[model samples]
Target: MLSGSPTQGMFSNSRIGNSESPNSGASSSFTQPIIDMSENDETELLSITWNQDYHCFAAGTNHGFRIYNCKPCRETFRRDLKVGGFKIVEMLFHCNILALVGAVANSHYPPNKVLIWDDYQSRSICEFTFRSEVRGVKLRHDRIAVVLEHKIYVYSFTDLKLLHQIETLANPRGLCCLSHHSNTFVLVCPGLNKGQVRVEHFGLNVTKLISAHDSQIACFTLTLDGLLLATASITGTLIRIFNTMDGTQLQEVRRGADRAEINSIAFSPNVQWLAASSDKGTVHVFSLRVRVSGEDSLTQPNVAQGPALFHQNSSTSLDPLISTNTGANPNSTFSFMRDMGSWDGKSAHGSETFLLRLLPKYFSSEWSFAQFRLPQSTRLIVAFGSENDVIIVGMNGSFYRCSFDIVHGGDMMQKEYVRFIT
Candidate 1:
């Protein structure tokens, strides 16, 4: 979900002094203000989203939007058109093309229209207008997804031809995620029923439905290859991972005992780790027991092949037995233990089932191995950076880069910090 504005008025011209924290390290402030404060213009941050590759992010503001590079933490450019503000600005990798939706504050670029902006041309080359406000827009090299309150529209990127329409449950948050892998195209969205997820595998022309949770889905995300999905429910205590192809539950990890409004969930590039952020203001990273299968495992399903079918094949599924064996190998177990830091190996489901057969399932739930605490007042989104590093972007205009110790999993070391907007 996108974060709401912290203040209503235009941005202040007065520079904010740097406040150093004992644990946050030395703050690296931007040399100049990213936004130009005109005497009459009013602006506030409406949204911030990282690009597909996590290299850069676009910040949507009431006045316009700005793009910033991720690693070095510097403003690359800004598009303060002044005509209206943008509620969402989605980038296609580092390309010049962007999918933009307008904020409610500006009628010039209303929320009902999606403007396909071309940075090279410095104008909207094409636009998609809808009956209702566009809640979100996602862009890929070959496709564009326009998310509405009750429906999602998929279009071909080449000609903007409508390809498919998916009916979903009330998706006020415009929850949608797409696979970035070139070999396959997978689109996941809310299903027709509550707590259900519809997975569209374009490569195989098949759709799989997974009942991810008993409660409504609060947040979810996919691995880069689109093979695995991580989902959190409105309860927000546990996050479940599923095999996108077969709708098999691979693993489950708990966020906490208390309920939280999960804001975002992210999978590491290698699919070995998963991270989640919520209203609790803490980012949790879990070492995954699931492994990415070979390319042959992603082959199209052969329904006529009987037991060999992808969906029916038990060997490929992460059944209880198979799931328990994950990371059980000597080398993998050692690595997993190292990554888990102080985590005892007792959390394994197989061990729990054997020793605590009469205990409640809650006692068997997997807890996060590492965590990074932030201000609880702000809603933040988390994503994996390089290796053990995690990148966080908050509604409070704060950006953080923290690294977890693979050998000690409690608190993450803050490597860098910056206030992108002030």
Candidate 2:
């Protein structure tokens, strides 16, 4: 989700200072807009999300859960948790509906439970309790997907009635993503296999699993409409995209040749661009329309980034896994990846795609475009504030706004960033 406007507001008792300072190295074509609202404090942000309407963004802190209007950037509404910490939060697009879970069980809301909040009333309308701890939550218009360590429970958003239950491997983080498109309600998650990705078409009662990687599946994301799905492995060097409706391999890109931890994947609203951030302190952007021969977008064998920071170059193909050109393919997790030999295959249009080998921007020594580079730690959650701007929040309670301007083909592009929170 993106931040909508500058004058949008947030209301909190905490005194906030607002001023715009010019950023250095901004493109001459457009001035970089930077908003530094406040400095860092004792509060630790456990979770943050923006409503679909993009009117406000919510953050969970030791102080409590609070919402701030976008344009004005002041804390708006807040509900402090008496005992527990809110770890995962999902908001229905622009709706007053919110789904919340605690990182640790508290007397008010247990760890193994999910609380549904109606911000209009400033209280939890209802809650769903489970036997195991709830790892993640995603809300669509009419459905709610709750992730468990080893299973997933889909429920009717209206009544919270049991809809479907899916069993996965031991999923500790409870990762899952829902399509942002209004017409599509698709869900994707880690499958039973170590490197498999499962896609569920909620309206059609159908599911497809793709052999995404040979290593453990680290993270994956779905485009706003759910037509495209991107998956990365624990090795974190490569990323593959698959069609959600049919299990056909659409495209693949490399994040780096060597192993790095992938943090998140995002698609532009137009679906023309994809961006990924890893612990290597870099964010790689790729064009979906282009294909690379003998390489994925970020994968260039033995090649290092412009800054001389990255090392390693290995690529994989999407063969060996059955494709469903005519009908749904088999989704079996019985075969281990190592036993399946080489999955390397060439793309049909690999030779036609242009190459983009720009050095990645460093957030730290490994700078991520979305995170604050602190001396000790950096954890960033990225969201689009507009078509060309990215809003990032650090775990240490910092917010950053990055804006890009009119593109000059090739590597000539202007960009600027503002510190919204510290």
Top-scoring candidate (TM-score): 1
Clashing pairs in 1: none
Error of 2 at 373 (Å): 8.5
What residue runs in model 2 are displaced by over 4 Å at the alpha carbon?
1-41, 50-56, 69-74, 290-377, 405-422
lDDT of 2 by residue, 1-422 (tens): 22232212222212222111111010112111111223334556777776654446778765456666655456655555444556766766655667777666445555676776655534445566677788888877767788889888876654445667788978886878887555556789889998888898775667888888898888888765565688888898777777676677765666656788877777666554566766765555544531222112123332212111111232323322222221111111111222443336634332211212332322101111222232333655555556655555555555555544323212212233334334
Candidate 1 lDDT, 268-348, residue by residue in tens = 876667899989989999877776543443453442231232233355435421334444322222234434444363445
lDDT of 2 at 157: 50
TM-score of 1: 0.81
* lDDT, model 2: 0.56
Candidate 1 has its poorest 10 consecutive residues by lDDT at: 19-28
Error of 2 at 282 (Å): 2.0
Clashes of 1: 0
Candidate 2 matches the true fold with a TM-score of 0.67
Best by lDDT: 1
